[model samples]
Target chain A: MKAETRRLTRKSDHTRQRILDAAASTLANRGYAGTSIKAIADSIDMQDASLYYHFESKDALVLEVLRTGVVLSEEAVNAAVSALGEQPDPIDALRAAIVAHAEAVLGMGDYPRANVRNFGQLPQEIVSAQMSHQRRYGKVWRNLIEAAMASGRLRQDMNTRAMRMLILGALNWAPEWYKPRGELSPGDVGRQMAAMIIEGLLATGAAQPVRRQKQGNGR
Target chain B: MKAETRRLTRKSDHTRQRILDAAASTLANRGYAGTSIKAIADSIDMQDASLYYHFESKDALVLEVLRTGVVLSEEAVNAAVSALGEQPDPIDALRAAIVAHAEAVLGMGDYPRANVRNFGQLPQEIVSAQMSHQRRYGKVWRNLIEAAMASGRLRQDMNTRAMRMLILGALNWAPEWYKPRGELSPGDVGRQMAAMIIEGLLATGAAQPVRRQKQGNGR
Candidate 1:
């Protein structure tokens, strides 16, 4: 609340953001075994001690990096779907959300990529925290899926819960194969998958992308 | 071949199969760090020395275990598609293949499950060998998807290569959330996904199962 305290808080927040960015890049390029506290600190031109002063340990830092991506993914998907506004078909909302997710993950440079690559390798101390965020993320996707199914726009007989997992798995796995400059953009890849999963690739009638698909949706 | 040599060859093959089977179950249950040559040997009541005689190293053993599942998946999907006969519909063939794959990965216990669970953690030496089999496996799925697209059954506008990757990603991720004895059988999960993917959930008019869908497609 005081002037000096406010200045310190702003600096602390900036330092945290810088550390996250550096760690995300390092972990993405180097993977779990190759990434280290010193490497991350060096990336940001900060001392290892200073880095630790802001975060407790390497596990704690890595967890924060992962949490940042998951939280961002959730918020981005929510925003994409909500932007659809009233009278948006449930199926269309789901597709836009999928595109939004794919872009957020692929478009955001290292952090989400690292989360996918090193997730299975993270120490339990970090992974447990990351998993909580992941579950919450899953919950949001599940709600969208349930809404789509309940609206009779998606199949009711099929298990929506199982379908939700498969859909997420498909989208989540995009980073492993998605090339930023490849044949298709991330939004294109997401739309392709959403059409395949939601509409059945068998038909030519997959739901059209909302005309107002938000800008910056492509990786 | 001489009778004595032929008999010995057959016995050697049997022992190799036994060792591979034991290794797959152990790795699936205990994970990479927890699994060892000694533990695999113990599971099958063989001396570690004899196990070494067959596998050379833990990496070799794990690689063979993974290869077994991928090889099985390829064969099963091939058989399913081939059984569709000369005039079979492409969508039906793809559906049957999807069911075959799901049953293989999620139904048959630990080998494939281990391949999915511990793939990211496996040492590069072991993983490199496993990946070759995976690529071959991918080729088979790609062919099916391409055939369906070429037939104008699946949407022609979507890229088949990208579609293949997304389809497999969803199916492969099944083991992470699938329960062997859950509400849906592995066969059912496969069928559900096949329908959701190939037929699109929005259509109640999608092709009904070919009733003659290959008998005993389940594990």
Candidate 2:
């Protein structure tokens, strides 16, 4: 009996995965407004009624797609944070987090665009679940920022919230312009983005001269 | 005779403006894919055939809408750059330019989104023209980065191309999430964006301390 139950669980999981794959492909091709339940059903070679058996509505299918995408992103952030556990430096932690985020978004490709397009259409309960997921993801970066600030690696006066928004805004919008066929890979772009934010355009030594003035004045 | 010519020109201009206004509203409401010539004409209380008197086809009408939007954006950018005439400080010039840009986009509201969505659907020539306008507008920011590097204001080793992309990417994508109804005005968001890019997250003094050891350390 236990063996039969385990086999049934595996079958259920496989069917659910197939449905999600079909949903993502349909969403990417047809967009939110263009896609329909019949199209998703046909893609998987299932009767339209079967999709209803699995999902309550087209919105439910979309919610499943979004949940899958968000979960993947959350995993990437967790992995990056875990990898940074070995590093003692706060800057390294921050850098790792940014790199992980860029990779996650690029890997997901059209999923993020679909998320942005369908955000308003999502049911309140689903939207709340997604928001909670986002808030948790955000805390990872915030923790890194706070660590950096506490360690004097980043400036205390730096508004962490605003910085977080800027970093996220840039990374999230990258898919619109980033082409895989282009010269830079997503990983390269991610590193470049992190470096630009961390170091900025000012020469490393240029600010030192200004800093000496305060010390000299004190002396 | 001059009065007759003036009246003819005024009527033509008014008709053109009316068609563009109708097209913008239609595109925003129905999206680029769903919008039709008849729908635009209906919005303006005209027959579909009457639309052809002003525009050659649906594509032409859409192109005209985009063209008008781009021209307005170009004028705004030009005005901003002109305001910064002979300013030696690149950071200040960049700030002023961003403020002007944010004001123009916020004032235009849904027009920019419509422009971005319909970009691929536009005729190649129209797309080229819009790109040319954008490239020219981008030069203002590029030139500021060059000037900052030429002066001692910014680090000479920094990647100006990447820096420009970073700043412009953050600024351009603001229309997606920024609500004018919020506590932050468009102008305020623009200023904050510039500050985030220019000043960076590190305390000004803290960034300079490590610069000497990391000169030419491009990622």
Cα deviation of A183 in candidate 1 (Å)?
A: 2.3
Question: Candidate 2 DockQ score?
Answer: 0.22
Error of 2 at A53 (Å): 6.2
- Supply every candidate's count of residue pairs whose N, Cα or C atoms clash at under 3 angstroms: 3, 2
**Cα deviation in Å at residue B150, candidate 2?**
6.1
Predicted model with the maximum DockQ:
1
- Residue-by-residue lDDT tens digits, candidate 2, B1-219: 332345345566687678788788766545555677788778778898877766666777776676666666667666876776665366677667766666555556556556644433343565685677556666766786787777777755445776776776666556555666665666666666666676666665543211111111111
Model 1 ranges with Cα > 4 A deviation: A1-19, A22-54, A117-128, A205-219, B1-54, B118-131, B207-219
Q: How displaced is residue B43 in candidate 1, in Å? A: 7.4
Best of the candidates, lDDT: 1
Q: Cα deviation in Å at residue A108, candidate 2?
A: 4.0
lDDT of 1 by residue, B47-82 (tens): 888876666677777877788777878887898888
lDDT of 2 at A197: 75
CA shift of B184, model 1, Å? 1.3
Which CAPRI category fits model 2?
Answer: incorrect
